[model samples]
Target chain A: MERKWNKSSLMGWQFVALPSALILLFSFYPMFQSLLLSFQSGKGTVYHYVGIDNYIRLFSDPMFKQAVFNTLLYLIVQVPIMLLLGLVIAHLLNNPKLRFKGFYRTAIFLPCVTSLVSYAVLFKSIFAVDGILNKMLLSMHVIQEPIAWLMDPIWARVVIIAAITWRWTGYNMIFYLSAMQNIDPSIYEAASIDGASKTRQFFSITVPMLKPIILFTAIISTNGTLQLFDEVVNITKGGPGNATMTISQYIYNLSFVYTPNFGYAATVSYAIVVMVAVLALFQLKLGGEKR
Target chain B: MKKLTTMVVHLFLIVASVISLFPFVWMLMGMTNSSSEILKGKFSFGSMLMENIHKLLDMTSLGAAFWNSAIIAIIGTVGTLLLSSMAGYGFEIYHSKSKSRLFGLLMLSMMMPFAAVMIPLFRMFSGMGLLNTPTAVILPTITTAFMIFFFLQNTKSFPRELLQAGRVDGLSEWRLFTRIYMPTMKPTYAAAAIITFMNYWNSFLWPLIALQTQDKKTLPLVVSSLASSYNPDYGIIMVAIVITTLPSVLIFFLLQKQFVQGMLGSVK
Candidate 1:
């Protein structure tokens, strides 16, 4: 029995060993190396230990600050809007009386199929100075002139936000829709029978019932927004004076686009890690405490 | 008044659906229109489809990019599913206190942003003389913690009785895993495959950095350059985008149930 137990345990290690090793090498090891790299200031291989310097630079760095501010603006503004839109859509679709549910669901969920870059490019062209959107708006007489959407800082950010919202709203909706399915309809039925309005039922029941999923979507959206790279890079190019530049794009620019500043890029990368850690912790707290 | 409200609701939904699907429609139309014609808001399909395809093929390594993307996505998805399922199974089926702790640790890595690890990963891959290879992209992500977690979560409902039953039949542990466990987890594997495949297909940041040369770049990377170019041809770019997007979209539609199941698998 002792030998058999030992053999089984060994088999367990055999299964897990390679994958764990790969994770340790690829994920954990690079993470540790990045931490070490963060401390040393250098362009490329030539480097020296500059303890606390990169961390200090982060506080006053304008580009860093702008990136952080833009990312948070997206987080604060876009996440709530997208999630709310998703919830509303999901709720609407959850209605038994709604016609053509399949068509609506599929049509609305279609945007998520586009690759991030493809969508960004699409949005970019549509919002271009003389692009389709401008032409449409012109025909509608909404604006006398083309908006120069991606060329302006503010409109560029809006376009970025709109692009992201377009891509992910369906994704979040699917989650809410699935979670809504698990909800017993009798609760909503009871509420309605007791003279509750649809709005009140949605707020009191659907929202509350989908709290965990809401929290889950929030965490992922927050995480995705924090590490936002593809859209910002493709749509705006973090340009019109870096208004839509995310920290990830900033890090990419630092390490690769500009003269490769490995150490400082690593430092900039830490800011995202810290933000993700904080937001994730705060969300977990928010979710757990409410539950 | 109730009828009016219902009309308003339907109108809102119709508007939203149109807004959502307009880009896909425009993209398809752009294939048949010239760059200027597209910018001028030509809603109808023009005669530029063959021209766009020819120009895209002629001007870029579109074929090689597609081939590379396919190879990477297929291999990466297979590897991710197999290895992650193995670890998930090992940790679940052969439960131990240490394995649990290790898994918890692995989960922590999931929260570590790719930006943080990317520089080092690039350096690590470069050092190993594997920077330009598909191996670099696949290796780091091959055994992701989230995939492992997904597999572990799905594996909970797996029948342990089957494993015990297999053991009694005198099959070796490896044989039991390959023959029995894998066969039973087909749905979970299918779900994971679609998600992993899409991820690999659409992956950009890492591939943008890793695959430097024209010949080795993925479709997304190629499309990115086309879009970013000074004299961008919207017709050709649209064709390239369609090609890059078609496989995943097809996969999503074909195995859509599994894709949704896979996505929700993580949330659960």
Candidate 2:
């Protein structure tokens, strides 16, 4: 029996050995090296042990501060709005009496499947000076002229936020919709019989039941927004004087676009890591991971 | 009052669906319109579809870029599903204390932003003389922590009785895995394949840094360069965007049911 137990354990290791090795080599090793690299300052390859110099520079760097502020603004504004929109849409779609449910779900979910470059290109054109949005507004006489959506500081941020909300609301809706299915129907029946309206039922019943998923989506969206790079880089290019620049894009610019400051970039990356970790912890505490 | 509420719900859904689908319709129309017409917000189709396609093909090495993207996405997806599923199965079914701890550590690795480790990864790839190669892009992502977590989560639903039955039939462990476990997880594999393929295909940042040469560039990078050029033609750019977006959409259409089921399994 002991020999048999030993054989099964060996078999287990055999199954996992290759993948574990790959993860160690590619994921963990690079992570450890970056943590070490964060301490060493240099251009390109030349380096010395700087010991927290990069962290010190982070406070003084205006670009870094702006990127952090922009990222935080997105986190505060976009995530709640997107998640709320997702919840409302999911609740609406969950209505058993609703028509064309599959069609609506598919259309809403299609945006998440689109290639980032394709959507960024689409959004950029849609918000261009003579783009469809401005054209519509003009025909409606809402604005006398085209709003340069991607040119101005405030409008550019609005465009970025709108683009993200458009793409991800459906994604979060899927989570809510799926979780909502797990809810028992009799609870809603009881609520309805007890003089509850649909809106009231949604608030009291649907919201409480979907708490775990809400928390899950919240943390995931927070992490995603903190590392928001692709949209800003592709659409605005953090342009109009870096108005919409995000921390992830700043890190990209530091390493690839500008002179290779590996240490500083690594430090900025850690800031994101720390921020996400703290936010996730706080969410879990408030959401109360109750089964 | 009931009639009014239903009308309101339907109106909201119709508006949302139109908003979601408008970009696609506009893109298709733009493909058939001239550059200036697109800039002018022409809502109608024109006689420029073939002309735009010809111009796109003539100007860029789009065929090579498509091939590069297809190869990387296919290999990356297949590798990710097989290896991550293996580890997932091993950790779940085998049930070792140390292995679970290791799995927990792996999950933490998922939270580490890719940007944090990208510089070191790039340096390592450069040191290995793989800077301009697709291998550099494929290697780092081939065994993603998220995929492993996904598989691990899904494996909770996989029945252990089948494994015991396979063992009693005198099959080797690896044989049972390949012949029985893999075949039984078709829906899960289908879902993972679509998601992984989309990720690898639409992946921009790493591939942008890794594949420097024009011939080695993926479709996204190619489209980006075209869109950014001085005096960019919106018609040709729209064509490129359509081409890049088509594959993921096609895969999503084909495998969406399984994809949703897989997601349900994970969340449950």
Candidate 3:
């Protein structure tokens, strides 16, 4: 059966043209609009074309600097820890002989599905000055006093990082677990017959095989952490001193929390864009070659 | 020694699951306790579920907000599935050098953090008098490039011979899509639906900025407001959280089969 390539047939122009145009409008237009918005400066009703003042001001703004620091802190500390834990857990669970694997998988994966409000509320309670964590620590004689996890600046950041890692590690695990399923079990059997220990086989075979997925999750997780807002806003409110403030939260505050500085807020938003683009380019260059 | 190691791993997993499941258990326990009791770390179940429910029902427009969320999620998911899958299918099926270049550009959009776009998005929505509508919340995300990219990646596994056969069958372009493409991609559609529904359902920032009134607020926004009260009642807030989370969990469980399979297909 010969497939016709006619105007009205399955390979027609309208088929591709409509979807392509939709992408151009919905995906491209708002982005271009944002690019334009970043260049202008104004209050609610007043407006002016400030060529690069907003971008220039970002370098000097103390709060913006703090937010940049906090975001990067999370990127460095939280991303590696979560990915590593996820990798370990996925390796353990990939054992076909492992007991109650389904239960373990669901239990970890369950956290990601928990509603943001529910988990945020739960985390706030668990990390409160007199919350379960402190209670447990005192009961176990780990500490004689209750720690102000959310009130102290350094501790507050710790709690935020811990909360993010806890919530997302399972999500990353799902990616790894799914990727692991594609591996032939015979390979593991082969390794065992050749006298490779479990840990050795994991490091040698599993890590290298799952490198693409690891990189993919790393990029996605980086994007997620870079846009970190809901957790900070709900859990910390960027507060006690701006210890846990993120760029997204700062952008939110600029746009809605304070007197609305739409133009300036757009500029801060673009800073994140530039950072993500550079980091993504670097990661792709670093990881893409190996794949 | 082998038994000891296995025992340790099992113990570790058991402890981890308990820790993981503690909050959910607490949420339920909190729903059953009073505000003061919850704040005081009362871990056991109480008899206040009905009271908490009553208080939450009276404090907010629970029915309207839930309805609004449902409508938005349902519509947004449907729109996302159709438009994104169309683009995804187009990009994968009609693969060309230019289309591939365009695909790379679309992937770049996925990397741009939403924080970078929120304010400009707000201004754009406000300019169109869309600040307080479901349309405002759903329109911008309806054709998200991330969703498009996801579908495109999954479409890589879609058999080309099926399309060739459909063409041989003298089916029109639309018929090939509606007849051949749609049915074969049920797993993909299911996964996309679950993800998009949750995205639209639990979406907080955009809806918070866009929707101004009490009636238009989503479950998350309403819960946020509830939790923010100067003297927030933990029991009541827990109830709100449970309500907000239930639908997504239920949707995920309902669609888990396809969700995992679709994702597996994409990675391979």
For each candidate in the order shown, give its overall lDDT on alpha carbons.
0.91, 0.88, 0.82
Give one digit per residue, the lDDT tens place, for model 2 in A151-253: 9999999999999988998899999998899999999999999999999999899999999999989988998899898889878889889899999999999
Looking at model 1, the pairs that clash are none
Best by DockQ: 1
Give the poorly placed runs of model 2, Cα more than 4 Å off: A1-6, A289-291, B262-265
What does each candidate score in C-alpha RMSD?
1.3, 1.5, 2.3
Model 2, C-alpha of B9: deviation from truth (Å): 1.1
Which DockQ values do the candidates obtain, in the order shown?
A: 0.79, 0.71, 0.53
Q: Which of the two candidates, 2 or 3, achieves a greater DockQ against the reference?
A: 2
Span of ten consecutive residues with least summed lDDT in model 1 chain A = A2-11
Arrange candidates, best lDDT first: 1, 2, 3
True contacts reproduced, candidate 3 = 0.45
Error of 2 at A5 (Å): 4.2
Q: Candidates' TM-scores? A: 0.98, 0.97, 0.94
Instruction: Rank candidates by DockQ, best first.
Output: 1, 2, 3
Give interface RMSD for all predictions.
Answer: 1.0, 1.3, 2.5
